[model samples]
Target: MFIDEAEIEVFAGRGGSGCLSFHREKFVPKGGPDGGDGGKGGDVVFVGDENLHTLMDSKYKKHYRAKNGSPGEGSNKTGKNGENAEIAVPLGTIFREDGKVIGEILSHGERFAAAAGGKGGRGNARFKSPTNRAPREFETGREGEKKLLKLELKLLADVGLVGFPNAGKSTLISVLSSAKPKIADYPFTTLIPNLGIVDCFNYRSFVIADIPGLIEGAHTGKGLGIQFIKHIERTSMLLFLIDMTEQNPKKAFDVLKGELKKFNPEILEKPMLIVLTKTDIDPDAKFPKRIGGIPVYPISSISRTGLEELKHYCCETVLRNN
Candidate 1:
């Protein structure tokens, strides 16, 4: 189950109460007051881990609470502090509180404090005065912080691959990376987006996301892109794949572009590449050199022709963009 969004509640531990006691000895009739201070409360923290790709764990567990602090003991013995609650999430996770984004974790081992613990109270010994020999007052512990959070995951990748269904997207990604996605001849074969790490020359590589296919009504939530388009918004570059054998390739490109524009015009502003797939079908066929102002490249994944050049170009383009 690939879950990208979740809601959870986090609470920090409460501080311990102060201790009050009077010193007593057999030899001395009246001994000064001897009391211990309370221990601190536990905090709730969130950490980013590269190993986690989905927010499925957060979806299953909706609430989290930290351990409470221990109370103080007599004879100036402080109580033990409570342990902290650590929550691990994937990179590119955004934390939102009350419909507004508070912070985001983008790197591995990144730590963010979701809620802070309460401070411990003071002991009666701290209240002792020179004028008053016996002062019987002590401070109380503070309450922990509590918050309701919304977690949203935007997949991190260097390049985003977008195309209509049956445009050879899965086949192309299979050749570019080790990811083995289910491929079919029909439309909408891929129900979920797949991330593949494309290895280029000299073992240099970058990440690519194969977003689900889009259709004419995709922008209106008629197809898969409505749910997967958010993934492409985070990418630095985009690859628009079109079928060369289609009756009119330019018209097909226009439809795809229109859908993307409707969703978010900013997406079209990114660095984009126009790719015509299935070039192996007609080696002698001629197509337009460019789509609008963007350069168009012809390639066939099965024949492996033009693939090497494409890989090197992708590597260079990503490096330049980075």
Candidate 2:
């Protein structure tokens, strides 16, 4: 039910038509035009709410439309305006029009006008002048704007955790951060990415995301696909967790790096820290010397060993990158 992307159509309300009426009192006969102007239509707006983490709410209801304005009445009485429609979305959501970015929501309670309402029509009373005593011509109401919008949610994190399955990624995030992700001795336990906020000394805190592991052929829609890899592209720094207990730890790390390169070469350009996880199982395993000239660090999440070093390294790496 975690929907990250959705396509929806939005329509603003139309303006009401003007009324054509003449005043005819009991005493005063043939009174001048007394028609009232029509009210304006409603607008469509999108708001960002931090409480929402997924786009699942919008996925259920695709079409959104505002209410139309009421028609003008006689006796110079203006009609009521239509009520506007508001769509709430999570923070870090991007609004796109025809694949182009229209706007981006970064903070809570921030709102953007997606579609504007139409203008009200003029009444016949305004047309009455000295030249024409009984003018009957009145302006018509204008139509509102309609658009097909695309909403894409990208988790805003300071650092991203990326690696292959069974690399002790979930355990590392759970131990380091407050995010209690489902951890097991199996692969693909985490289907969706989890976000956690890691706080360091001196009130320094940064957001970390536990993106699902990527496997070989992930760029070609194999082994949980490359969606996990794409999510890491937005992170300021990447923590590549490799299972040291694997028979070929070097090849495992290489495959993970290769998948990332295939997904986006820019990902490899980001600041990366290699974490050799599951060291408790095989503490003397021969880890990789260098993958693309990046040094690897051996750590065990269960034993709480080398965690401080990894945390320090992550903090320094993030600061250096910034």
Candidate 3:
């Protein structure tokens, strides 16, 4: 039910037309022209709601429209303005126009105007002058602008856990944070992204996102990895977890790195922490450390081993980057 992308159409309300009428008085025989200007239309807006984590609501409903303004009255009264339409979406959502990012919503209550209302028409009352006693012409209202917008949700997390299936990435996230994701020994257990808030001392907090696992050709859509790879774009940091108990940890790490690189070169530039998961299988194997100069932390999420070190490391990295 966690939808990340959606396409929607938004239409602004049209302005009301002007009204022209002759003023009649009880005492006077004749009266000047009494015309009223039309009211302006309403706008279509989008607001970011932090309480929402998915774009599922927008999936079924793709079209949004505002109400039109009322026409002018005969008593020189202007019409009522149109009602505005507001659509709520998850935070960290980005609006695109023709595949290009036009706006981004990162905080709650943040709003963006998707379409502008049309302008109201002018009345004919101003035409009265010395040379021209009365003018019967009136202008019509202009139409509102319509737009097709594409919205994409990129989860905002302080830490993004990335690895292959059964790599204990989910276990690490669940143990480190308050998230309780479905855990199994089989591959591709996590099909969607799981978010959890990690609380530290002094009320410090951060969001961790655990997405589906990656495969060798993940970048080529061989698995669900490519589809969710964009979720890592907005993460402040990455936790690359590898199952060191496997025969070759280096090869696994390389495949994960290669997939990231293939999907987006910028992913390689992100701050990463290599974590060797399930160290309970082989306590003394520093298999992850042999990868290179990258920071490596060997920990067993199930046994609660080296958890403090990993937490401290993640927190320190986040703070340093901030």
Candidate 4:
């Protein structure tokens, strides 16, 4: 039920019409115009809620409309305004119209107006003139705005884990944080992205995201990688996880980098670290101390070897960058 994208239509309320009435009294022979003005319409607004993590609610509901204003009454009394329509959405939700970016919600309780209500019409009393005592002119109300919007949700995390299938990304994240992702020996085990909050010294914490594995040609929709790759765009740092038992760790690192660069070249500019996982499985295996000028950290999720050092480094690096 983790929906990331949805399409919906929004409609604003319409204004009420003006009332035309003539004042009449038992004693007076002729009374002037005593019309009342109409009330304004309501707007369609979207609110951000941090408790929500997906766009599932928007997926089922397609259309939203606000309440219409009431008509004006006699005796120069104005009508009541319509009620607003508010829709709750998750943080990091982006709204688009006709493939163009309109706005985004990144904080809790943030509101964005998708459509505006129409203006109210003028009453006949506003058209009273000294020369024409019995003028009966009245104005009509205007229509509200309507639009079809697209919603896209992107995860917000401090660090992103990048690696091939079965490269111990899930295992590493589980050990580093409290996230429990489905792990198996086969490829494409993780179909969705998982987020975890890693606590550091002094109650400081940072969020980490573990997305689906990436393979060669992932940018071309080769596997599940293309669908989940965009989830890493918000991360401040990246961790390149590689299997220490691989025949050539350097080639693996190169493929991962190539896929990421192909999807978004800007991702390469972010600060990154190379991590060799499952070190306990191959204690004697040899890996380069550094890959492509980036330092390496070898750790075993099962035995918890080199985990404290890695955690300390990640905490300090993320804090320093922030």
Candidate 5:
């Protein structure tokens, strides 16, 4: 399952209490306080794992907690600290608390401390003084931190495919890379984002992301909505794919651009290319030389027409931008 979002509660371990014992020996004349300090609690941490692609584990397990520290023992012996609880999540996962961004893990083996452990308490021996040698005062351990956090995962890719339903996005990616995404003639065949690593000449390659199709009201929760749109926010470039079979290609391009602009205007600032797909279906069909000042490339994934040129161009553009 491709679960991108999840909510979880984290609880840090509590510290142990201090011991209030007094020294008792057979030969010692004056036995002073011999209490030991408590051990510190454990923290809750989140680790980034590149191998993980979904937040399914976090979704199923909504709560997490660290081990608590042991209490202090007699004979000036301190308690053992609790073990930390580490939760592994996919890279590019963002943590939020109360609608505010807290932290994010973007690299493999990276860790983020979600909740902090409590401090240990002071032992009775620490209160010993000249006037009060037999001090009995001891401190209690502090409580650990608790948090309700939200996790959001965004796919990391070099290029993002932006298009409406049945625009041949999946078909292009399948031919360019080893990624095999479910493709059908119907709309909304791709319910989740698919990634493919397109290899260019000289062993150079770039990752491409194909998200769910967008519609005119995609920014307003229509069709697949903005759920999959955010996955492309981190992309270095955008590829606008249009179906040549559409009656009004210009209107389709405008609508796709408008939806992206409404969701996030910065997306328009990225390097982009306009691709008209299904050229083999209508070889004699005419298209604009340029759309919104961007060059257009018409290709047919079925017949592999113009695939090499498109692949080379995409690779060079992505490599240069990087």
Candidate 6:
């Protein structure tokens, strides 16, 4: 399962306490006070790992904690420090604490401290003075820090493919890249977003993401709803595909536009390419030169019709924009 969101709690270790003792080595006179200082606590840290893409591991286990420090010993001996705890998450994951964003992990091996450990206490040996010799006093340790946090993951792709169910978007992605996504003749075959790397002319490469299909009332929670839309929010460009067998390509595009606009108005302003798929099934379908001032392309993944032109066009457009 592709779990994009999850909640967790982190706690740091507590500091150790101080110890006090009096020296009695059978000397001629009385001995002074001798005490040891306490050790410091551990910290809770979060790390980014590129191998992971989901927060499913955090879903089952919610809490993470560090170890507590040991107490101090007599004869000026300090306690052992606590061990630190490390949590690994995928890159492009955002961290939030109490509904406010703390920071985001954009690359692998990135580290962030979620909680800080408490400081150690003072020993009684340092409290000795000329006026009050052999005086005994010890301080207690401080408590550790704790926090509840939320994590959200966003996809990073150069191009995002958007269309209704059974529009041949998955088939096109399979042919374009080496990503092997499950394809079927029915609707909603893709439950999660799939990413693939497409290399174009002159060793130029880009990442593409194919999200779940959207329906007419997608913005209102119909047919995968906002879940699919959020996956494509970070794409540099969008490729909108329409089935060639459909009666009205303009209406299909309009519905997609309305849904995207309703969810996020900024999405409508991004550069987009209008394309018709499944040309092999309907060879006689009329191909329009332009729609709403945007160019149109008709392609067939099975027959590799117009596929090269489409790839080169996307590469050129993305390179120009970037």
Residue 22 of model 3, lDDT score: 70
How displaced is residue 67 in candidate 6, in Å? 16
Per-residue CA lDDT of model 3 for 1-322, tens digit only, reads 1239989998999998877777888997777777777788899988989789888888899889998877776667787888889999898888888888788786688899888888777666755678766677666777887988998886488788999899987888889887799999999999988887787667777778899999899877887748777666667799888887767777887889899888778888878888888889878664535475677888898789999988887777776665
Candidate 1: regions farther than 4 A off: 1-9, 12-91, 94-155
Provide the overall lDDT of each model, using Cα atoms, as 2-decimal numbers.
0.84, 0.81, 0.81, 0.85, 0.88, 0.83
Question: For residues 266-319, could you state the per-residue lDDT of candidate 6 as single tens digits?
Answer: 877778888899899978767888877778989999999988888888888777
Candidate 3: regions farther than 4 A off: 1-10, 13-91, 94-155, 288-290
Ranking by lDDT: 5, 4, 1, 6, 3, 2
RMSD per candidate (Å) reads: 10.9, 11.0, 10.5, 10.2, 9.9, 10.9
Candidate 4 residue pairs in backbone clash: none
> For model 5, how does the per-residue alpha-carbon lDDT over 201-262 read when each residue is reduced to its tens digit?
88888889999999989888999897667668767789999998888877888999999999
Point out the worst 10-residue segment of candidate 6 by lDDT: 226-235
What is the TM-score (0 to 1) of candidate 3? 0.59
Q: How close is candidate 6 to the true structure, as a TM-score?
A: 0.59
Q: Give the worst 10-residue stretch by lDDT in candidate 2.
A: 227-236
Model 6: residues with Cα > 4 Å off, grouped in runs = 1-91, 94-155
Clashing pairs in 6: none
Model 2 CA RMSD to the hidden true structure, in angstroms: 11.0
TM-score of each: 0.59, 0.57, 0.59, 0.60, 0.61, 0.59
| Clash list (residue pairs), candidate 1 | none
lDDT of 1 at 203: 69
Error of 6 at 246 (Å): 1.2
Clash count per candidate: 0, 0, 0, 0, 0, 0
lDDT of 2 at 282: 69
lDDT of 2: 0.81
Candidate no. 5 TM-score: 0.61
